[model samples]
Target chain A: MLAAPFQAEFDANSQEFSFAGVVRPRSVDEIAHSISMFRNAIEEARGVLYINVKRLAQMNNTAFHAFSRVVLDACRTRSDIRFVVVTSSVVGWTERMFRHLGKIEPQITVEVYDSKFYPGQAFVEDTSFIPILRTQTKMTWRHERKILPRHGMRPGITMADICCGIGDFAVLVRKEFQPARIVALDHSKASLAYARDVASNFGISDIEYSYGDASEMLLEDNQFDLVTCRHSLQIFNQPDLLLKELYRICKPGGRVYITNEKNSHCLGEPRAQSIQWTYNEVARLFAHFEMDVELGPKSRRYLADAGFDDILVESFMVTNQDGDPQDFADIITAWENVYAGEMAVKRGDPPEFIKRFRQGFRDHIFAALHPKGYAGWPIWAASGRKPL
Target chain B: MNAAHRQPAEPKFEPLLQFEMEMGTFLSDWHHCDQLSTYMARMISHNRTDPLRHSNFFSSALNELLEVSFRGGSPEGRIGCAVYRHGPKERVKISFPCPAGQRQFFREAVARTHGNDAYARYLDALSTDLAPSREVVLLDLAINFDAEIRLEEQDPPSITIVVDLPLEGIVS
Candidate 1:
């Protein structure tokens, strides 16, 4: 006699039906009311009717059978109406299970959403970039450990690290906060493999490193007390799509944490002008690839537009002075190779321009290693509370 | 398992997780299927290459089998579920209340899903417009998941069913 922990909503404007939550019932009779509502909605719909089960975390055979019947019957009755069953790759069985109906009914088609939405995933997926990512985190974690508490992180809370590249940040969070549970997800299989290997080698068995698309994730709604997606929103071509998903998974009264870099703001002494020009080009370079390396200051607008409130935004400088200058120099060295060597060449920049760009990174590293020098990379850390 | 269908030298399976409850209690609430399936999937999928993806597939398959146990058999006996693993293969074993006639019905239903025409029959059954209480769990799991299903008669009013799912090896 427990209440059904699921919902179905029909939108007349787009002719889409959304099913969410755990959709299990004792029998078809138990959901006859919702079934009749579905039947009526399809009767008046025209063109394509989208049945979005991307957020439908679980469904039983009884419910699936009932839904299949309704969709197939609707297809047979309305020849003009096409049914598109939208499933998410995060939920493994939905596409395959519903795909059978797509095969049997010509009018029905099943499309998995996450498989196609990762616009700039390739830049971050390279296994060769793993070391730089680790160095970047080692530098940032110092500032983040201080900033995280101001953003609602605490012990024993459920947490999720989306776009958790290589999962070093999640491991740091696990050790520092000791959250009750942590689920770290990323789109890169290679990155996750490395992350899994690192965690296992260290005997850190608590964190769950999962593979998933950031824009259209498979994690359920309102599950995490604190959700962190660091240095990720900028890399995705469609930042809003990724932000919307981050908002969706955050629990009411919880917070979504993010960090992004405005690459042009990078600074160094003794080679200030050259470094400035190169970092600006780095921003432009990322833009050419449909990513925004200069999205740091826009975090407030992004979070507010996604319907979050009590937004807290702060900026931190990861400088050579923060730690060993060697670590900072190493990160810059990797960046030069990827940005000027690979990316500029791919962008078809002149050799002279690539050489000049490479020079700026070399100067920044020089400044980092110089006894009287300073080099800094500024990042914005922002968090917004999901209203209760 | 039938001697005719058993694998020549299947790998040994060690029990990983188990849950036990009376049939009447489990059947009394429909939410158990969802809650239990979600919990078990999360528990068993931690080591897969894609834990989220593997868990989703495992949960879907487990939910279907749990539903079959929920709807079939009498409500006067105990029901138990045990999960076992051998590398990438995961097996779910469920024991539930059943009568002799209901056991025969299940055996015959499972039998229909073994041959080459099983998937086609599954499609046909889906579109046939049977009664409101139509049962097609076995056929769907058997064909869609390529599950290896075995049913064993227990005491007078109970039966145990085992399903082996090679979830990680699947391309999708």
Candidate 2:
């Protein structure tokens, strides 16, 4: 369960000693060498020595006792150098535990680093995009409901839907699966508000909508039977970190299910070439924003590399044939606005490029509403079981 | 129902989860304190309003208790942990066979934590170069968590430490 060992590093440039992972040793005897290294770093620091415990998930009282003494003694002796305890709120006890250093000596201070985990949070969290998000979920849910059972989802199991956009899928899964518990978490406060409203209107009292950063979730380890993060991994700059978290929260023998789109593969008959060009551009546009819109087929390699066993991956197409063609058309239209109007414009694309970029989405919409049209949005669904 | 006119229902806590393990084996390693606290926190806190946050706080509090027991108690009998709740309040009861020294430690620590100068004692415990601190961990649960804690003698040489945690709001 302790995948990473306790380690400390000193950066002279930053005047910091950052500690990560579990650091519980019997007395200070086991960690005397590391403490000495930390002490040396503190002694050398001129103005300030920051002791960062942002990733230090757990520390027994024995370890903390040793650490606190070092800081206190340093404050008394090294009057010139100041001490700052940089902590992450992800580990709930850290700020409170380290706050005493600041209280005992004014030279020592504690600061909790909480925000800016998600760079694109502001843009994606805009409430105006919620309509398009709901429509995207609506179309995808049709294929996912059938695909889910094939990927270790069943009734009566505990579930967590990380990055649960607009909470539409959680509602659908709750209605379909009747899970014992469903904790739907998202970084967007606006998205969560919309999701909770939808749940309340539907009289669905079971689903718990929580606000969180998916990459560094406060959720406990091995808590859920099935952990689902749909259409989210491709958007992050670091998908591996997210996969590690998904792997951590899922119980041994439980499955982590994810879905992402290889956007360039989206096809529409009669305007296939135009649609293809637009999606390829869409992939590049997202890449410029540090996101990968073409992470679909790579799902297998990601799960396998993350030490998962019994991987299951499948591709599904949400076509104009499903429920309403307008819904499929709406998803494309919204994509054009965000991708071409917002993302492309932000990338400083010329008018000539933006004009042509907007036309492809219009053609895709026309094809979707056409009598004999077969417009399609391709998605990859993958799941891997955590080894027991 | 109107916001002002309608009366709220009375709060109650019912049995939710309970499990037991051999005290000797569990106390053999310090890591067991973390393992048990983590597993229990994740499994039990899902029913709370905010499961992840609740679990985070619960694990911190529970780990301290488990670690204290690990440091002080004898590995002679069963150590059982039971969690119960049907409302905002959740109760945790950990019962194990204790040596006289362990019992006395809890009695003195609980008394010190409940006194008017509890926060002062906690600060004093932190400032001192106390090895394997007897008071800080228990005092933290009492002061920071706003936990109501007491020790009860179940049988001769066996004792149960009960903690009532109003953990839901403090997290926010």
Query: Against the true structure, what is each candidate's TM-score?
Result: 0.85, 0.75
TM-score of chain B of 1: 0.89
lDDT of 2 by residue, A202-303 (tens): 988778777677876766678899999998999888999999999999999999999999999988988889888988899998888888889999999999
> Where is model 1 more than 4 Å wrong at Cα?
A1-17, A29-50, A74-83, A149-157, A215-217, A220-222, A237-254, A284-290, A301-311, A322-326, A336-372, A385-388, B1-11, B43-53, B130-135, B168-172
Instruction: List CA RMSD, all candidates.
Output: 4.0, 5.9
Residue pair clashes in candidate 2: none
Best by TM-score: 1
Instruction: Write the residue-wise lDDT of candidate 1 on A118-177 in tens digits.
Output: 545665677989999999999999999998999989999999999998999999999999
lDDT value, residue A72 of candidate 1: 87
Reference-based TM-score, model 2: 0.75
DockQ for every prediction shown: 0.50, 0.34
Instruction: Give candidate 2's error at residue A95 in angstroms.
Output: 3.5
